[model samples]
Target: MASVWAITLLGPARQRRSHNDDDHHTSKEEDIDLGPEPCIFTSTIPAWNCRNLERLASKTVSPLVFAHVRASTEGALADSNCHPFSRGALMWMHNGGIGGWKLGVKRRLVSDVGDRWFEAVGGSTDSEWAFALFLDSLERLGVDADDEVRQRDGFGHVVLRKAMLRAIERINGFIAALPAETREQGDVRCLLNFAVTDGKSVVCTRYVSSRTDEAASLFFSSGTSWKMQPSSETGKGAGKTQLGTGEYKMERRDRGADIVLVASEPLTFERDNWVTVPTNSVLTIHNQTVLIHPILDQYYNHTPSFLRSRGFAIAQGQTAEDRKAAITRENSAAALDGTAKEVAVA
Candidate 1:
């Protein structure tokens, strides 16, 4: 239920870690290069602290960065509960909650995962527990979630996506296995919008457990560069710079997508610059190419224009609506300018 936001940069930049307890402490700063440097940088700060967030942003440099701002819903207000949970080399962020978490899902999920993952949990948030489940999923898929070599070399996108889908399936099973009366008394449907990365590739999902209901809103934007638009003060003086001061838009100079952005909501109000990730689907960004694969299951809705109710997502504090209703045709046309392909994955 915590509202989360993340940004992934595919090129080189400086990486830094800022802790809430050490606001006055000077954290170590290192450049993340393609050769031997660490691949992921994460910053978890309280959503209300604008000054600290600005200070952290000013010193950031990384090709891959995930920033999390926490709004406490299920966990105590503490730094440990802040998101972008990392284990080994993988990072995770979730914008939705597991259905019926307090009823029986929490106890069942805690007992279901392996001991290593269970003990590795550092916080009391269900979001962190979900990350543990994802790590366990990777292990069950014949991949070592903690292997140093694989962590540095990268877990292929295919493997990560498979694990993501498997974890969702397991979550659904937990909800379904609840006592009949408990399931009847509580809302057992899940609104799972997850983002995970192994530092080289990113895989995100916009999924709902009920076929008739829409998933939480997840939008993506891709282009050659996320450039700042011209402003009235540009080129006016030597000391003035408009890089971060002006509005920015996705600029497509070619077919290849040098920049890819996936977020829980449209980063900008420019509707033509964003495209909605279809419901019940997995979106993968690897080597700058975007691929979307449908998550076919009992909850999958095959209709392209299916009108799903937004009541559940709205009540959960995340909005969900039809693409046609949310984005303009020009936006869909702009999406075609990038290198996005949809391949069937059964």
Candidate 2:
């Protein structure tokens, strides 16, 4: 089961896609400006109507953006199991599952959150639970998770980044608290590729709980416009082809990024147009500028030119053709914030 979520922040033309629909074949949306750009729309039907979505996509244009299509690893098929869960102006989504979710990790997570966040979890997936934990972390940090003021004024990218890191830390705590027998025999390393946005700034993380293993795949592309080639040149129609099938390029006429895109995989075969968000790092897209910050934790490996095994991501069908080469940059994880030669992500 895959889930899709999109937000289009536009300076001139902004509209929100609502989750409520009148029927199976029809979709619903509103033109009211919520001051947060738009409401996230999601669907969980096994079959996707690409044409319908393309029609909607063609009509809407955005500036600040985020999206996700999830393949569940630990939940039943249902609408609530989709990505892009929301509360007020905040939207969240996750790729990958909690390690030891079946061994009472989910219970531990639920028990740790407050009553409001706990009762708000509508899905049974660990991904949604992680979102609740994120809201909890924000509240604990003195930021009101449900306050409309923060939503309108923007939950600073730094705030979201710290809360996201703390949420992952809490998740690690849950897995660590599992019984000794469960820990000894279980596959406890988690892949937590997370994305969160409050309609202004965006923050995302590509991480794994193990130092030597790779997390699920995450790639980012930044440029002026995500334009598609003429169908005659690439045999792919522009704006008509669905997300991953379109032949697209990042037109870099200048250094200022007019558009920023992050995906579980590259949407096109354009290699120079995309860069790998270094594993165990946080990527922030604020003011259309991209910043990469390494996640320093116990699972963080600082070995220069260290290679992470692709076996885990491969098993989940998330491997890329140049997967091994993605992390070949010389600077080690520990030196991300220190004195080290910087590697250009684009």
Each candidate's root-mean-square deviation in Å?
9.7, 8.8
- What is the RMSD, in Å, between candidate 2 and the native fold over all Cα? 8.8
Which portions of model 2 miss their true places by more than 4 Å?
A: 8-37, 46-51, 233-245, 322-346
Q: Pick out the ten consecutive residues of candidate 1 with the lowest summed lDDT.
A: 34-43
Worst 10 residues of 2 by lDDT: 321-330
Residue pair clashes in candidate 2: none
lDDT at position 283, candidate 1: 99
Global lDDT of model 1? 0.77
Candidates' TM-scores?
0.79, 0.81
Candidate 2 accuracy as lDDT: 0.78
Q: Give one digit per residue, the lDDT tens place, for model 2 in 248-339.
A: 77888988788888888888887778899888999998888889999999989999677666656665556564534543432455266475
What tens digits encode model 1's per-residue C-alpha lDDT throughout 1-346?
2333344444232445544447766666555554322333333444444564566556765666675554677787665777777876688888888899999999999999999999999999888999999999999999998887777778899999999999999999999889899998888888888888887898999999998777988888999998777554545474554555547788899888888988777777688888999889999999989999999999998887666656567667676344344334324433666734222111
Give the clash count for model 1.
6
